[model samples]
Target chain A: MLYLEWVSFLGLLGCGLWIFLKLPIEASQGFPQKIMYLHVPSVITTYLAFFVVFIFSIAYLWKRELVFDQIAKASAEVGLVFCALVLLTGAIWGKPTWGTYWVWDARLTTTLLLFLIFMGYFLLRMSVNDRDKEARLASVLGIIGFLDIPIIHKSVEWWRTLHQPSTLFKVESGQASPSISPELYYPLVASIIVMLVFYIYLLLLRYQTEKRTDRLNQLLADTQD
Target chain B: MKTRTKFVIGGAIIFAVLTALSVQGLQEMTVFFYTPQEVLASPGKFENKTIRIGALVQKGSVEWNAQAIQLSFNITEDGKKFIPVYYAGVKPDLFREGQGVVVEGKMQGPRFEAHQLLVKHSEEYTVETENKKNKEDYYKSIQAQ
Candidate 1:
């Protein structure tokens, strides 16, 4: 845990310096293109965090393990933060380049839906009083909510959207090469790696807190009895 | 009815309405804009209806009326078929010739009058060595454009 914390902070610092100072201004969008490092990394991290939630939710259902549920809950909290970051950063980036902050296009709308579904995930978790019942219901919702990610990802191609298609994941000639130039692409790759490390650190910290909170609640219930 | 049953019924009603509204909205916005060729292909079909057309801003066809606060440009797909567009709005920062744009408005006779103009940035990225290395050069480049 200590090592992850150190690595992520230092990694992020290095990437930040490399991005702002070392990188050249992109041709079309000028300085505003710098937001891509922050925006894209958070987008990838959000996808990964929810993917963790999806996995653990399935594991909890299969094994009926409270630890699985706790892990899923921790990852969901982290995912929600990153998801909000995606929306915020995208909006800030959009104002200059796209000429609008928000559009009701499929990509933007489906992402908003993902955020809302998870908001309801927490609400549903809280509204149910029984611990086991809460886990069961939330796991189901988590599974259902994850189904939106694929649709959100494909919406740009499936529908006409103002948001540009994937730059990093662009596939041409059966090879996976980013449309971004090498000078800018390398730093973006570095930022994404550092962001994932940061995500792992957050997940571990949140999981510890969730575990302790459950233990404390159990202790209080025993004392009251 | 029992309290639990009433609560269930209320929840069901709310869910149904929310689902209906979203489905309707989703259907409407699924196709955000039509290509220039599609509009040209069927002009009478889209005559007065408010629609959005996505195309590249034609080169050297832009005329900005600063005092009147109107921007007029021709949008084209293959450099052959063109539709002249008149917009009354602030010019977006990225608005320039040869860039992709999506305009929302109605077709007025042979010309299109747009209310909203959005720039569609390409996925490709490049670093212009002479144009974008420093702050002054960047400003000069944009000014040159």
Candidate 2:
């Protein structure tokens, strides 16, 4: 697993660099639009990570298995990192495009709320001493936090926001169509694939570390007895 | 009932209630931005409600007073339907005639009283040759004037 992770990581880095240097600059956004390749993929990966957390949280609660809990915790941690990257790249893009670094638009506000809710989930875990109780509470929070995903996805359509609607999945006049030009679409797809593979690699590494920690704790508990 | 069954049912109930509330909130909170044609077509429906309208700035319609900090322009769609806008605020640097803009304000009779104005710019990068020619032409036009 470690060997595979390093190989994929190197491949992702190479692909990312190639796309950055070779992709054609958009006519309107010029250089700033390049941030989209990073920003969009980060947000997509964040959503995927949270979805993993949601599923594993439900599994943990249903089966009362420590492995499921470990996976949920690991995914949440990774999701939070990607969510923060989304915000950072978004802010960088916003400064040049919108003439402001931030706005209280519905989409932006909901995304921030999503980030905060997960932060609360982590805080709740740290405050609890009992392992089972902590898992139960965090799983519940994780399930509730997943609700924000749909809200964030539809915020642009649901409210008047400074943020533009999705370019890839445009639903204008009740018709869904992709609006991206071919020149921009291919590189974006490549970037998203690279980011997603990297996300999976990180998730596997985090899960392995979590399993090791759990084993160490069990050994220590047995020795104390 | 078993605790596991209870938790599953309770989680489902909470999820349902939250989804319902979100749908209700979205209905009330959604303020759709309209074009000039849409607003003009249904003037009575949007009266006094804060709404956003986007269109191209009509050429030669801009009136900016730096000292008074007042800006006014006519926004047009299809170059036929025009909505006059009056705004008292700091205009964005990109505010110019023949550019796309979206203004948020309430409609008062035939005019839009704007609270905020956002300049909508394209994502395309200007080519170097075009940029140089534009600069030269701008200077030449100013000298001619």
Candidate 2, residues A160-197: lDDT per residue as tens digits? 56676677676557996555667778777777888888
Chain A TM-scores of each predicted structure, in the order given, are 0.99, 0.95
- What digit string (tens of lDDT, one per residue) describes model 1 on residues A94-172? 9999998998878899999999999999999999988887997788788778878998898777777777778899877
Docking class of 1: acceptable
RMSD of each: 6.3, 7.4
Highest DockQ against the true fold, candidate: 1
**Model 2 segments beyond 4 Å from truth?**
A171-177, B1-29, B32-56, B59-71, B76-81, B86-100, B104-115, B120-145
Stretch of 10 with least lDDT, candidate 1 chain A: A156-165
Clashing pairs in 1: none
lDDT of 2: 0.79
- Candidate 1, TM-score of its B chain: 0.70
Q: Which regions of candidate 1 fall more than 4 Å away from where they truly are? A: B1-24, B129-145
True contacts kept of 1: 0.71
